[model samples]
Target: MNAISDTGAAGFLARFAAMQGRLPGDSTLRLAAANAFRSLGLPGATRGRRVEAWKYTSLQALGGMSFRAGAATAPAAKGIVFVDGRFQSGTEKNFARFADRADFGELSWPDRDPMAALNTMLAEDGAIFQIPAGIDAGLVHLTHIGTDGASAHPRQTIRLGAGARMTLIETMSGSGCYLHNPVTEAHVADGALLTHIRIQADAPAAFHLATLYVAVAAGGTYDGFTLNTGARLTRTEIHASLNGPGAVAHLNGAQLLSGSQHADFTSVARHAAPKGTSRQTVKNVLAGQSRGVFQGRIEVARGAQGTDGYQMNRALLLSPDAEIDTKPELEIFADDVKCSHGATIGELDAEQIFYLRSRGIPDSEARAMLVRAFLAEALDPVTNDTARELLEDAVARWWEGQAA
Candidate 1:
């Protein structure tokens, strides 16, 4: 690595190590992760867009910040609560219900990525949601907040037993110049189902990086949806492994950005067993000088025959200066597998806009409607009524703010 990248890495490690005593979880693992990060260094910048994975998005915002550890507050299970890394009184019952479970961190998943390792070393506290067998876990709504100069790593884990079902809605928002790194691990057992909806609308001065790891067993299903309309620099990465036959993974997300904002969505779906299915559809609407990125990869193992995988990324550039970069990949070793991936970048339909304007609809409203309709492909998969409504409202707010 060069001197700039080295300085950033060294500073990050030194700060994290100094705060090791204050971070949550076992010290042994934390130290190990920190040590690993020291050797990996930071993911550097793109040399003339040579790095395909990070060609459109820049890490300068995250690298320039001087991050300090923040407290991981407990969450209260109310109708809807916005949390900013603080768990106080009046949330005891909800906190205990989530944290006191016996299988808090039982599942074994290796953290090989440098970003994951950094999260492990700096994570202060996290939320845990475990659903028992044959039961339906109700809605969980939370808003994670961040403050200036405070770097918070909030870890969350959701585990479902056989025949279990649940829905989670988490919104990330905050003010000031902070870096929020959130790590989530979800395990779905045989015949179980889980729906995860995440909304990111943070302060434009903030930096957000989140990584999610999901494992699905036989007859299991995992559906994840993300709506990104915030942060100066944001990256949402998800990795799903279909570990057993008949497992299905569907990942969908939309990124609506304006001004100088940057958002990246990267996902990898692995089929480790036969008869597994994975689907991904992501949409990006960019305006002003914003930039959006999507990197999706699907992998089919040697013996994982009868696998079905599909991926599509579509971006609408609302401004001349706006940009979008999409890289869709497929690595199939199975002979009997079917997989396809593609991306399209275009502008708003001039004819449609003209027709809508001639019909007495304002241009702004017409464009917003078109954007919403375009994004519905990714959002419509969210079956939970409340979560869908909330996401729609968030998208509306973002449009209203960015409307021309």
Candidate 2:
């Protein structure tokens, strides 16, 4: 593969080829991923300016950078740290109950060769987290700190044993001039419950691409929420499989962007077994010249009878220059399954603004209040009160900054 300038199709192909070779191994899944990358190819001449239903955010402004491995240092607390895709070890005296392995060999993926596929496609290094059966681990904090002067890739895999429950909090923050491409794979066994909270606060010069893949077993539950408040360009992808009967998944995400920043949230949930259920909600707030995108799809296998799925995406634009694109889809083959999707894009309501002003509230505060109310629908799924409060505070701070 020859290196081409960033603008051409050949350049994109060459980059993909290089990633494939640098990946951990070669597998059928890897080949499929390579094919998908090829299909996406490169952005056209109007790459960022074009309006695509699935791509509301633009990555044109993010310059490419080389990825380098980081040293293995100790983490500050008990949680694990991955800096530039390598594990750093230091323990905060309070750190306890979290599992970490420098090696990916200990992790297991039965449905696919996620390690090889992700490595080849993403060309980044990450870590694995495991929780044993019957353990009610309160909260496992995973932090990605990018100290690398340039871009980096970090991948993670989390496994929860049967009858176990855990809460995972992920914080992405760093100062640098590069992109952060992180992929996380999660497995929840039978009767297990896993809650995931992701907060991203990358620098203005940072570009981010994060992916989460989840598998839920019989009677298992998976709940996730993402708050994207930082970065010049950020995209998060969630792909889940309802692999067993009575499995349930609830996915919610919110993005607050201003200036020239952009964020994209995309997800796909598949029902492979009967009696599975899934619900998805995404809310976005765009201001200045920023852009936001949300794309969600639900698929019911041919034999997946009694499947139930629902999806909704809503966007609020605060400036004429801002843009939003939303797409919600449902593909059901089973006759007994129930699935539906809806999307809405609009500005603040004049009636509500007048109502607030009539009650002596200022315009800026009233707008911020309404925006927070609009977002509550998505934030309600966060099960932890403290975590939820933190998320709300993040949203409030972002809105206050916009108002100022």
Candidate 3:
């Protein structure tokens, strides 16, 4: 550990002192969570670069930023909004339709992630809902915003009853060099279905860390996608468990990064029951010395027979200094299972660019077209119309800027 992370308890204690009484959640729980974070200390850039999990990411810039509480703002139109760590007004109208299906709980994962613990310790408010069986909860939108150098921790819990269905869209926007940490837990009961889409478009100097944990019961399905186009540093971590037979989980995402930005997407899919299925597809577009990281792991339990797992990651580097790192791992203990994973890194195909250019398209436009096509393959799995449209629009806007 370097001096930055090795600050031990002093660093955490100082931060806790600055925003101690203002934190959300039960006091006892928050205290325990803070202690947990203090125990692990922070991850420093000098030492973090050597750690297996932090090999490609650095935290030195994070330590240099001084983060305070964010200001509370009113809800945006037609969605639940969280400003800083407080929920905005007017969300009561959607309580019956979307806001009442989740409840807060201690979301403890197998790994002791400091970011999650810190979020739990400081979060003042979060969304919780429990959708009843046979209900179509319609589309629910949640927006999180940060201002200036402020920091915010937003948490959420969602439970879908049997035969229920819901589509959720989460958007993050902010300015300056703020730190935003969000944690989410979702449970899909038997025969239930859920579609979740997250878009991160924070300021060019912001830091974002998001963690999601999901459990799917028998005959249930979970579809999730994340779009990362902003932020100086970001890490999106997802953990999914197929707890019952015939459960399905689909995770797909795209990262469009430029400048000196860095984005990392890590996920783990566990097949605990027989005949479960999991799929992961990720694409990255990097330019201007930007970096992208993808780490995906699929594990089949001892009796998880008839399991099917697939993972694919592709990267397009637009600059000589741009970099992409991908690792796909599979561990199967079952006798009957089909699993495969692949990763590819390259620039735009010269043949495709040539073909488009020969057809009257400008070189820049041809490159943008190729980039759009590359991301489209990863986004094709999203079936929700509204969510898909929103993501497509974001991708289109990013591409337009790139071409310009």
- On lDDT, the leading prediction is 3
TM-score: the better of candidates 1 and 2: 1
lDDT of model number 2: 0.71
* Per-residue accuracy of model 2 over 1-404 as CA lDDT, tens digit each: 34345432334345555555555533454567555544443223223333353345544443243333344343464466666565565343223221233233322231233223333454445666667887777776777776544445565677888988888887777776555767677889999999989988777777677767889999899988899998888888788899999899988888999998878888889999999989888888888999888889898999989998989888888899999877788888899988888988999999999999999999988987888888776687787986787788778778778778
lDDT of 2 at 352: 99
Clashing pairs in 3: 24-124, 100-129, 101-129, 101-130, 102-128, 102-129, 102-130
Ranking of predictions according to lDDT: 3, 1, 2
Candidate 1 residue 64 C-alpha distance from true site, Å? 2.3
After superposing all C-alphas onto the true structure, candidate 1 shows an RMSD in angstroms of 4.2
Best of the candidates, TM-score: 3
Give TM-scores for every candidate, taking all chains together and pairing residue i with residue i. Answer: 0.89, 0.81, 0.91
- State which candidate, 2 or 3, has the greater TM-score: 3
Off by over 4 Å in 3: 1-12, 17-26, 45-51, 92-106
lDDT of 1 by residue, 330-351 (tens): 9999999989999999999999
Reference-based TM-score, model 2: 0.81
